[model samples]
Target: MTPPDSQLPLGRRGLLAALGAAGLSASARPAPAAQRRLPLTAQTTEGPYYLDLALDRRDITEGLEGVPLDVRFTVCDTAGRPLPKLRVDLWHCDMQGRYSGFGEQGDDRAQSFEGKTFLRGSQRTDRAGIVSFGTVYPGWYAGRTTHIHFKVINGARAVLTSQFFLPDALSEFLYTQMPLYQRARMRDTLNSVDGIALKAGGTVLGAVREERQRYVATLALVVDPAAVPVIDRPPRPGGLPPGGPFPGSTPLSGARPPRPRALEGSARIRAMVPPRAEG
Candidate 1:
């Protein structure tokens, strides 16, 4: 069982202490300087469609349609310093909210997209603590809103796993622009309605803007390169066995795996404390 936030070291409690002693207001102190890196992105459910395709490239969109989006993910430490030369893997649904390599997905299990690999790839961070991906804005599905998944790794140690969400207005705008996405029935879930977004204190939302014909979204994923990921175990091929479930799903009795190593000290800090949301 997960411990309460208070019991967790370098968690919200430590953040509160710093905020109390410092005379700065939350709104006044921004997270990053040029592109301020936040401390550890929030850990979300890996879902049922995370497959390491072994394709490492920046451009993952294999001839999809929608507003082209350039995603910039910056990795940094808790001190707001950038960490260079790290591996970051990113994946998301296509313009129609259908993931590649998955036969079917969604709440009602209505999709039949199989062996399709698009808008999913891996890249390593540069000297500036960033991994830029050239892809299109993702569409929505039945139960979840518009979002993307990412994982940061150091050697074999999985340090962090998280998701980034886009504003509803942007998602709504894209659906109207592309006729193909219009067929994907819009769900009731929005970023604000997502439980993980709320718990992470809105840090999970990507700061996006339009640049000429394409949209550029940027967000910092802070993590400790040395810390073990706060997941049940390393990501397995095709997610779990046939009956095995995702993180938030009901597990089959005696099928659940042991939790990953207990996070210690400020490693817990990077895993626990959500970065202050920035515009």
Candidate 2:
């Protein structure tokens, strides 16, 4: 089943503002990012560097095609329920952690969200395994701390990879005299957190269930029906890698999608399908 790459680009436009989670109105082009290039550095935490651009047909420059990401949460399964199509893998950095790829310096296209990568992607979980993304609201990234990393593969590999924070009671009333967050709060500090909870050890849970612009939570994984870990691994970031997902389908990304738009609005961008069901 190793067959899905075509180079993966066609038309060129809809990146929902380089996927920092995309939230705009009052005017579509507002995402012009006001000429961007604002606060740009790195090392910040709160992890999960988001940038793939929701379900991504690569988007239509902003008309926002499928238009998902109104937002929702939870994907329990330790004793809970729903684990249906499990495959979440978000990425973050942008509220300032200045991430886009490699070390990130001038002209990756010219930064801002540069050609925008590192915000990573992937999302599945329906039939009840729910999932959400239409992101935006991440904005303070100078040198770390804000968090949102997640994992729940269930099919080929990775069964969990936690980290979801914000709300140390506002960093203990504005980081009391420092000392590593002094007395800590946000659901009892990481006890000893560093470099983003050490790449998320012990399933982090600092706090903050819901904040404005957007941020929600709920995650739990424990899969080990007996001993499930074969992982031939291969079909990711490209297409159909490990070969496990096949309920309704749609995950094998080696490449292909990016061809149809011959005259949707003329400007170009096509490859839209689905129109049969005859009788």
Per-residue lDDT tens digits of candidate 1, residues 140-257? 7644557888888887766887788775545544565456567634444455444555566555667775565566777877787788756733343243432124223454565643
What are the RMSD figures for all models against the true structure?
13.6, 21.6
Per-residue lDDT over 1-279 for candidate 2, one digit per residue giving the tens place of the 0 to 100 score: 111223212222233223211111111011122354221111122222333344432111132111011233345443444467777666544333344542333212134444645445567767766766554323223223445554556666655544454432232222333232233222112212334444444334322333432233333333432333443332222122111232123444454322111122212111111123489
The TM-score measured for candidate 1 stands at: 0.69
Best by lDDT: 1
Q: What is the lDDT of residue 33 in candidate 2?
A: 28
Top candidate, metric TM-score: 1
- CA lDDT of every candidate: 0.62, 0.35
